[model samples]
Target: MINGSGFEWQESVSQLINVLQRSDFAASFLNSIKAISDFDSAVIMAYGVGPTPKILHDQLDDEYKDAFYDRYLKGAFILSPLYQSYKNNANGFFHINDAAPEGFFDSEYHQKYYCYSGLIDQVFYLKQFGAGVAIVVSLARTRKLPPFSRLEKMALKSIESIIISLVAKNWEKLANDEYKFCDYLNKAFENFGRSVLSKREKDAVNCMLRGSSSKSAAREMGISTETERSYRKTIYNKLNVCSHSEIYHLFFKSLEFADRGEDCDPLSLLWHSAKISH
Candidate 1:
């Protein structure tokens, strides 16, 4: 009985059937959702036992999309309120605000990264597969609009079962090959600075790598700008790197080296020497 602007349930069903028959089921599924409800943007992501999240589909603005993957997905995904909810095995539609920690909007990660989207409200339609795997469909509303109303939430909720079924049917095809890069990046983050970098230092580097400025990173970490700058300096000294660019290059190079199955231990002689000097 769902109805929208010239949209009927029968047509929606037909659209879903047609999409399921297509090669790109994920894209088709998103389109089908659009035919039912209007959203400013949407993204479909798969989280697994590993660290990297697999993006199955997205309809975000190009710049926002880039920032999401290049910065947020790299490390901040762990801190994402929606991701945490998914981890807790929470399913169904969730307002982003409802899922976040108290004062999340004031957090630096929200200010530095999430704010870039200019979205005022976000909702995730989450479906969990197992203990460490889940798929999330994120819908966002622009600042110009009000938050999603109860009717809208119900409309999305009504389709939850269908979306879950579609995702379950198509996940193997959508995610199998797309997870490799994230896997590598996760490994790189895990082994790269573990022995030398403190947790806060690593968090700063992760923020920086995703293109946050020192000020932004500092804000996200809930520290003063001076402390942020100090952390950056400490990271540079510990890694024995002269610049942020070098650190960036070193990270990817390590990834490449690891891909080649070479021993790229960051805790070798160089790390010890840097530790001694500091």
Candidate 2:
């Protein structure tokens, strides 16, 4: 029951879901976006939490992408109104140069960073995903091309919803997995440093999560205070969280407790409350 272009899009969605479910986190995401949009280049940008909005993945001509990243670091397009407004809101924005302001895309900033970089038409989609609070997926065509047509935009919107749901589900699993792993660590006291923990910087994290203060955690793990601090830093970094409190909020409260039962979830209560509010 599949047609021509419609079937192509359906296949794209299925492939994207698979990638999001099981693939190298960054590479797969970029590949999916590129496939869906039929664009020459795509990059996923994460903002706010990091030192800068990082180009986590880009499938562009390397000479183009590297120069774009380099100029991007030099305050090129970050100041554009289009970029600013997109950063201001957590939503998707799509446009051609004609659709943007008269001088906006023509500014010196735009020309050097975006125009010359081979990005003629652009689509910027921002939302929460993965471990980051704010993630932006930007797809662009370096060559001059028409903006996405009405049907294409609809396809993008549909896929965007699927992407959000998938991210939420995976984060839920990670949270549950972390909680279970922590339980095992607490009771065993056996070295968790080798296998799964090795990839996750587990020993130091387990020590702290099991109620060791940073100083005590360092001593118990037999690493320098600085090394312990560095390990803790990586934990927070990879998790896209700040304090232990935020960690609890994201992984424990939202993901972990939500899985416990509907009766125990604050979001569930809020959902029911909203239903009654109207």
Candidate 3:
């Protein structure tokens, strides 16, 4: 018997069972969570073998949805606290504040994306399905709402098992589709700068794609933060991109070209265009 802090766990389970049967399981999952503790918005993403996370579902405002998919899913996801937690193989529900790295709010990523989103608080329920595949269901409260209380967290945690089970069953079928997407992305990143960029510049781009700040990338590369910044600038110049958002778009467009079996070389095209503009 399912029990929780004044939540109808059994009903939720029943609904989830029905929802899982549908083709749109992601939307149904989000709805089930909303019934228990209503949040301002929600997002569901799948992470696997790719450098980018695929947004399986989202309920963000239309105005921001494209920006999120184009920017966050493309590159900014690397900087997300929850995404890092998933990388570390962390599972279960967690508040954004709790999972965030030290000085996270002060970071450039927060300023550029999280802060601009106007989402004051967030909680993610993470489930890992081995082989580097995972899904994160994020519930967010707007700036006007209060943070999720302890009781709310407890109630959500109580139903975690049911959620995981439902998602796992659906994911088994979904994995094949995701595999292809991941393969394309992996190849895109692998071949992205092979012809034009130095090894260090490529490494810096990969680090950035994984959501690393200059400091974090520097730490990993055994270089000074200033040196990391220099590498980023050089990479951007070589690629003819000015911002992280543009980098994400470039990666996405390249992957799309690959999927279509086109003979187009997106990087070469971008480089030539940039050169001509100079």
Candidate 4:
């Protein structure tokens, strides 16, 4: 198997080299990775100190584009552990199970988008370069295939340096103007309900969004279990939400009316829209 894979990898690299500095490079690069393991779709994005990420290349099927492009780009990427890792300056290969938050598989964020998109597993190849710009390739697997095997992981790791070096060299001069924007949607989530929820209540909301239970949230916040429960209740009352699920739903619903260039609680706008509609 190793010798067979070696031959395949050599061939893939030859094909990739042929496309260097061309529009087809990213697509060819993804195909090169196929020598190690299979993936359903792939997207190469350039992220920087900006409100949005620039899609350098992609071969996403029609089914997953809405979830990956529209929703995730709009605001959902803020909750992605992969995106958070990039923000924190950690780069290289990251698999979904290794990178997601605690209880992330069970979180509403995962269910609503990851599962909704039919993606069962995802792996990213991220490399930061040139100030705030980072290039990341997300390779996803749908339910049609099992997760990457141990041997495949080893193969990917062994060649990580070669791949990342080529990627950085190919995209080193990506334009900054193509990537900058106001991060208003992310700020809306970070400061959500700030006008109505107290500091403690805000913490509780953050915990809830990340799929933390009351006890777990309290432990992380250095508060008692009962205090966390009380905070949750207050949040529900202030936001007029009834349960954990409602809180998660409202988070995105409020985003539909987010102030695109301002830091403010998006919930207020949601309320105003509701009132006006009536």
Badly placed stretches (over 4 Å) of model 3 are 1-7, 49-52, 182-277
Q: Write one digit per residue (lDDT tens) for candidate 1, span 122-215.
A: 8888877664578888988776567777887778777777677767666644445444333444455556676678889888876666556667
lDDT of 3 by residue, 1-278 (tens): 11233456567667677766576778777766766676877887788746577677788876556657776776566558887788789988888877875446665567778877767788888888777788888888776678788777777777787777877777665455446344444455556665678888878876776556688788878999999999989888887789866775676555544443233455665566667989
**Stretches > 4 Å off in candidate 1:** 1-7, 172-278
TM-score preference between candidates 1 and 3, better one: 3
**TM-score on alpha carbons, each prediction:** 0.62, 0.49, 0.65, 0.87
RMSD of each: 7.4, 20.2, 5.4, 2.7
Report lDDT (Cα) of residue 30, candidate 2: 56
Residues 49-103, model 4: lDDT tens digits: 5777778888787977888888888778777776766777877887777776666
Where does candidate 2 have its weakest 10-residue lDDT segment?
181-190
Model 4 is weakest, by summed lDDT over 10 consecutive residues, at 175-184
| Of 2 and 3, the candidate ranking higher by TM-score | 3
Q: Over 4 Å off in model 4, which ranges?
A: 1-4, 175-178, 213-227
For residue 14, model 3's alpha carbon misses the true position, in angstroms, by 2.1
Residue pairs with colliding backbones in model 2 are 118-142
Candidate 1 clashes: the total is: 1
